[model samples]
Target: MLGYAAMNRTLREHDPPRRCNRDMRKKTWQRDGIERAAELTEQNFEDLYAILQWNLDHGIYLYRCSSTLVPWNSQFELRELPNYERIASLAESCGDLIEANGMRLTFHPSHWCKLASESTDTVERSVESVEHHGRWLDLLGLPRSPRYGINVHIGAHYGDKAATADRFCKVVDNLPPRARARLVVENDDKESLWSVSELVEEVADEVQIPVTFDYHHHSFSAREHSYREAFALARETWGDVRPVTHYSEPARLHGDFDARPQEHAEHVAAVPAWLRAESDVMIESHGKEESLLRIQT
Candidate 1:
């Protein structure tokens, strides 16, 4: 009986009551927003290239490059395709296509686990990796493209949330101003300490870094927090900067596995008019074709 009571007490402590205040209920809109979208699949570079071409033809302005298609990881040396110059030329060609269509490209590092071992402390390493990649982009002259940026998650729950936020700020501060300006931090799944509100508040207060309003992460991480509340917080934190936002279907088990493709238009409808007025939204759905169709419809 004592053991049972103790277990119940532990569970109660872990699952605290939700806090939803009236101030958090306001509707907000993003100003001069853009409908950015990504082509996500387990597909290879050729498929991604074809999808890019299609999006270009259709006048879609924003796209995300799959990390798998780029040489992002330094741990395992994968086989070189043709030549380093070819890879650079390919990226330049893609850049030209996007420029011709008046589009932008954004990249997300493959999950923290894939970037380095689970044992590796990702907070510091993630920032280092960003800086490293920023240098590569500078070398390739890709950052000079009309719009290009890297999106990353708030660090995993290592210790105190406040301490992690401080570390994150320090890392962001260390980068060159131009590179720092291009970095957009995103909220992660429920298991991470930096939920949507937490990330927005911390970045705004500490780093003065912009937030990426990821709809699925907001829904998954703060299940009790309404979408209106999430939008309000995002607007309050990062104002006027036309944030790069992501939208996807909520994962069932709180991990990377997306259960179904997000209905982009339906999700957009749910977005309060206020948020729509101020932010550039990106659809990160499972199947690109269907997701884009939904957005169009």
Candidate 2:
């Protein structure tokens, strides 16, 4: 099945502009505290249910939810939200739709989450970021597994590949079962950074985590492996589960020759047949659900 990331253009253009990524700035969070977070979180949760229902209605079951589903959740326990009960009830409703219809929902925490950072504070914050995402999935009552994966990239090499990966593996080994079981790493988009083969050998091989293949990133960091070869290696990491792959055409390829190679096109023309056949490909194009809809035709 094809999937789309956080936004849904069609829904966003609706009367009140439905969206699940409602968020607050730092000053706003500080001024209002948990109450404000509770309000936004409730709204976000409610819209998330709407979004999921829309996806199921459109036959797009794979969704990547926003990390801010519950804003400022890392600052306090989810139970501390004034509307926690209502929020939990709403989440269960979304989960029911997901499970009853065999849908898959996932989260990709922001790029700042760097578990492999040399600084202890950054690593701690990163761990919290990942754990909070896992907690959200739990509240939604999804099974604790990679199927509802929390995908991430080890975005930095920190000048020492061996040491960096060592830190990453240790952190993964120590994460609570909630985050650990659902963690999946992705190949990076810079040549100097991680490739699928490197992740397969360094991280997944050591920590038993699945590797998510990003099609656009492969060209930047192929590490001498063909796309099929890299994908096959990443696929092996998923074990019994269907591997998840991210697909997007570069905007440059889509006629904006000046656009960066990593910039996603507004909409993808078509997905490769083999990728559609084997994995749940999340269309990373800017078109979101509309992109999936276009290719479906």
Candidate 3:
């Protein structure tokens, strides 16, 4: 099944604009506190349910939910929300819809989540980030499996790949089951960063978690492997579950010649047939769900 990340354009065009990723600035959160978070979280969950239903109706069953589904989630526990019961109900309903339809739902936390950071404080915050994502899946009542994955990228090397991988695995081993059971790491987009083979040998082999192949990222961090070869290696780490792969064209190749190599385009023309058949391909273009719609037609 093919998918898109957050923000459904068609739904966002509705009367009230239906998107789930509501957020607040740190200053705003400090002033308004939990009350504001409660408000946004409630709206986010409501919109999230609507977004999932909209996706299923359009033949898109896979999605990466926004990390900001609960604004300021890292500051406190999910149960601490002022409208905890209502928020939880919304989330459970969303999960029921997903489970009933066999849809695939996942979360990719922000880029700051570096489980292998050199600083103890950085690593702590990173762990919190991943844990919250797991808690979200738990709230949705999704199974504790990679099929409902909480994917992330060990995007930084901090000048030492071996040590970084070691620290990352150590953290993964100790994560709360809600997070650890659903965690899957993705290959990075820089040659100096982690590659599919490197993640498979270092992280996946060490932690027993799956690897998510990123087709666009592979070219930059190919490590001498072809796309099919890298994807196959990542696929094996998934065990019985189908691996998730990110597919997109660089903005440079998609008409913006001056754009950075890592920049994704507004729309991806298509997904390779094998990727569409063997794995769930997330169309990581700027157009979000609209990109997938264009591809489908």
Q: Give candidate 3 misplaced runs (Cα > 4 Å).
A: none
What is the C-alpha lDDT profile of model 2 across 19-137, one tens digit per residue?
98988999998999999999999999889999999998888989999988888887899998888999999999999999999999999999999999999999999999999999999
lDDT of 1 by residue, 93-120 (tens): 6556655665666667646721212344
Estimate candidate 2's alpha-carbon lDDT, on a 0 to 1 scale. 0.94
How high a TM-score does candidate 1 get?
0.63
Per-residue alpha-carbon lDDT of model 3 for 1-297, expressed as tens digits? 889998888888999999999999999998999999999999999999999998999998999899999899888898898799999999999999999998999999888888888889988999999898988889999999999998889998888899999999999999999999999999998999999999999999999999999999999999999999999999999999988889999998977998989999999888999888899888999899888988885
lDDT of each: 0.50, 0.94, 0.92
Candidate 1, superposed: residue stretches over 4 Å from native: 1-50, 72-82, 113-125, 144-147, 176-179, 221-225, 235-241, 251-277
Best by the TM-score measure:
2
Sorted on TM-score, highest at the top, how do the candidates line up? 2, 3, 1
- After superposing all C-alphas onto the true structure, candidate 1 shows an RMSD in angstroms of 16.7
Q: Model 1, residue 119: what's the lDDT?
A: 41
Worst 10 residues of 1 by lDDT: 1-10
lDDT of 3 at 93: 98
Worst 10 residues of 3 by lDDT: 288-297
